[model samples]
Target: PAEVPAGPYDALLEAAASALDANDFDGAVQAYKNVLSDDPGNPEAKLGLAQAELLGRVQGMDPQAVRKEAADNPGEVNAQLAAADLDLVGGHVEDAFGRLVEAVRRTAGDDRDAARLRLLELFEVIGPEDPRVTAARTSLARVLF
Candidate 1:
């Protein structure tokens, strides 16, 4: 990656991104939270927080904390993705679908791809003709086909 302007907490953010890339998600989350506490409106910080929270949820932990973050900071793609995934994990398929849809509305990024893949898998689980399956199919087709 080309060099970019240093963020407010360059050292901590670098540490967090490195930890996240290394899959030391717990440490990454703490580091991200540290930056967020001081710079709540930072997009990079918001993205880190969202991704870290998602990673925690994927590891069978909580994700509710990020829901409000996603709602408040709509630019955080990772949080929206994580929120959608967490909703699915919690058996709230409809809620998860809504989150993914909201994600699509918010960011024109790879998060939509992730959401589409998850929606496809979830559709399989929910079975065809279920409202969730239908919605997911429609949304997936909108982007993928």
Candidate 2:
């Protein structure tokens, strides 16, 4: 029996996971991107990259402030998106999905489209196999078309 050595991408994947664990979102993103450059279909690298990118956008944001802004300005798409991001990071998966679904229900035209796009991005972050994502997809479809 012959033993196979680990591929070079293995180190990059490890670095990406380590960076994610350290909350070094930028580092994780770069590492994941490096992995994808070599193996574009790698699910773990894609998921890691998506999560890092989402976390990077919301990094250093105050959850309470974002939530208050969303509450105070229900019509503001950016505020709602920010609040949803915070909720996702905080483990409030249902809250995150609900916020975006509500936004989709209330908005129209480009605003509605924007909310829909953000919801899809959240789906990517949460992964398609997650039950929460499955439920959210059904809710989104009901609100959408």
Candidate 3:
């Protein structure tokens, strides 16, 4: 992918990052969307939007409850998904990736697709260049194939 040049959107992206730092996920999401509207293929904007959306989704969640649910219901795909989100937010990147990859290994049809998509979204949030993401990609492909 070609790099998005340093342009007016730089300030907007900075503001979006500030919003994320401040836990203002809605503001960050909107800011990212605004940038995407103008530069549809901007990688930074895409990453910011994914992070904002994930933060928003997990913001109200109780970590303990989510973890318990996931642990108790290993076959429950949604529970796994929620727990994976919380794991990523809590900086357990490996745990998040492993959980979803396991989910993909054990599930089929829409459930497998959901877990796979969530894992991909997390890849965007973490940046595709991260070694962990690369490892997870390999793991995911192993399960998928």
Ranked by lDDT, top first: 3, 2, 1
The best-first sequence of candidates by TM-score reads 3, 2, 1
Q: Which stretches in model 2 have alpha-carbon errors above 4 Å?
A: 1-8
Put down candidate 1 lDDT per residue, 1-145, tens digits, no spaces.
9889786699999999999888788899899889888987666766676566555657754566767877887767777766777776578988877666666655565766666555554454455668767876676557554
- Candidate 3 or 2, higher lDDT: 3
Cα error, candidate 3, residue 136 (Å): 0.9
Q: For model 2, name the residue pairs that clash.
A: none
lDDT of 3 by residue, 1-145 (tens): 9987788799999999999999999999999999999999999999989999999989989999999999999999999999999999889999999999999999999999999999999999999899999999999999988
Query: Each candidate: what lDDT?
Result: 0.70, 0.92, 0.96
Candidate 3 off by > 4 Å: 1-6
The model with the greater TM-score, 1 or 3, is: 3
Task: Give candidate 2's TM-score.
Answer: 0.86
The prediction achieving the highest lDDT against the true structure is: 3
TM-score of 3: 0.88
Write the residue-wise lDDT of candidate 2 on 24-118 in tens digits.
99999999999999899898898889899888989889888888999999999999999998999899999999999999999999999989998
Distance from true location, Cα of 45 in model 3, Å? 1.0
